[model samples]
Target: MKKIVAMVILASVILTTAFAMTGCSDRVVLNVFNWGEYIDESLIDRFEDETGIKVNYKTYDTNETLLAKLEAGGVSYDVVFPSDYAISEMIKRDMLLPIDFGNIPNFIYIDGRFKNREYDPENKYSVPYFWGTIGILYNKNMVDDPVDSWSILWDEKYKGKILMKKDVRDAMGIALKLLGYSMNSTNDSELQEAKELLVSQKDLINGYYGDEIKDMIANGDAALGVTYSGDFMDLYWDESTDFSYIGYGVPREGTNLWFDAMVIPKVSKHKAEAEMFINFMLDPEIAFQNSNEVGYTSPNTEALRRIREESPEVFELPAYWPDDSIVELSEVYVDLGEYKTIYNQIWMEVRIE
Candidate 1:
């Protein structure tokens, strides 16, 4: 029964029993582990139909979780969607395979800004999947004051009414940003300071969570929470107009600009097939459909152009893409290496508090 429920929720795409006998008699399977609810359900079925590749989809809520699974070395996956820092760590650990761009002709559609990024400087280990900034999502009716700074989360008036991210990097990154420190700070003293601040705010927080924050905020379970830009947009606009009371903004103190990218694991047996899957997703129509369903910024220029031309109104929403000022102020996290153990210890202390 648990397996049935898991299949229903994750919506893993298996070839229909009939298709297994017909089109997929010799099907190749592509195992994908990604963030939950990050892709369009229809796209999985479509990919299976067109390519005869069976998708065995799984999801993990945090980059750490993904890393742990890959490191543990029990299961094998063809492709994974990991954030920028995770990709950096994986490359350093020799966990990923270089992408063969020749098999991915649709790579030309990706925006130039998304290419040759710091995480995979040579574009060898990863392909940009979705990109966004971290920000505060608040209920307009519940919060009376201006909501433009990271300090608002620490405000005594809003104590016990805040939702904080459960993930380490994001949670500590917020504290670091609040202190005017870099989110990717390697300085031990600075990391310790952020840890102390997070511990101090533990009592004020309603709970720590992952993607459930979207539903929790929309349903009024919490007045404000730190969330990805795309999650805020999906909840505030796409989910229901009733959630119009919700607002998203990158704090004046700045935040993290994050990118989740697709990569082939070194252990993957289906390298060429994995490249085929990446190329298929980069097609303009498919990319557009994913952007619309997932409510995240696509790295594909053609897809974004089509979206803007079709729905001129989305541009009015600030959450679709942030202003240049915010983009300039925001920073991306890099592999902390040995310093990550310090972060883990600090994060564990915060959780206990």
Candidate 2:
């Protein structure tokens, strides 16, 4: 009887080992890195459940931060979300892998206007995710001035109540646009002038913030802030927020018309799984859910139509879907290449000052 029991225990151990090895070999894990608060978390769970592909997700605040991590070369991310200029930089460095459109059948849902953009002209390496403009979000009760141009940010009257983005490219772009220069200007003298403008406005700036800027302005912690169109719209449409007292405007001097997209990194181990996830995100119903939850303008044409149909009031707001005139005035950011170092130096000096 004792011998029989020992044999049974050995068989149990062998079966457990076999089961563990089988599970380990069959499981597929995809690592996704994206902007903070950019997606609906529920969709991630749903994707995992449907595909049986476990997702390891993480978030970063700035595109620069995302670029740094990708450059650092230690960690591996299967999928990443980066803005237009950043995508250009990555493609220049051969950091991205060309996507297989055959696997992404839902790519048909993306709006034609968003495709073939300058950053990825052929639409080979990236998939358009969200698009918007940078602008001022101000509290009407706190400031009586017209918030039509970038110059209003430097007004002395709102001195201690002003906010700027902590992001280098965005803040610098604002200064560049105000100087009547292109936001993508690579001219050293023009960049220097923009830098000086930021330095001059530094004293008036209450603080430099990131995603928290939306909440800060919403809570009336600051009178005015430079923020994304989508960030302002998110709060504007929220039932809990007082919409009557807040306003958002794309400055007349022009602003950054930015596009953030998804790409598979060359470092990706599960390229197929990454493509699957990208395709899943592009599904019309899933895209609508994400766009509605995050309050960003979806690049998915079907999703855009759904939003307009479901929330016609959103389209009524100029800031939500700017007219063609505003589109003509706005400029998309492009890779500055080696000139990025100068912008970085200028930003550091402005912050330290």
Which prediction has the highest TM-score against the true structure? 2
How many clashing pairs per prediction, in order? 0, 0
Tell me the tens digit of each residue's lDDT in model 2 across 1-353: 99999999999999999999999878998999999899999999999999999999999988889989989988789999999988998999999999999999999999887888879989999999999889999998898988888998899999989999999999999999999999888998998899899999989989899888887887899999988897777777689746778889788777888899999999999999999999999999999999999887888989989999999887866567877676777888887778889889999998997
How much is the lDDT of residue 110 in candidate 1? 92
* lDDT tens readout by residue for model 1, 1-353: 99999887665345455565765456788998889999998899999999878999999989899999999998889999999988998999999999999999999999887788878889988889999888888888889988888889998899888999998999999999899899889988999899889988988889899888877877788889988888777665564366678888778787888899999998898999999999989999999999888878898999999989988676655567777677677888877878889889899988986
Model 2 lowest lDDT segment of ten: 316-325
Count backbone overlaps in model 2. Answer: 0
**TM-score of candidate 1 relative to the true fold:** 0.79
Off by over 4 Å in 2: 1-24, 72-74, 155-160, 192-216, 219-221, 237-244, 344-353
Off by over 4 Å in 1: 1-27, 44-76, 192-216, 237-241, 347-353
- TM-score of every candidate relative to the true structure: 0.79, 0.81
lDDT of 1 at 169: 92
Indicate the residue-level lDDT of 203 in model 1: 84
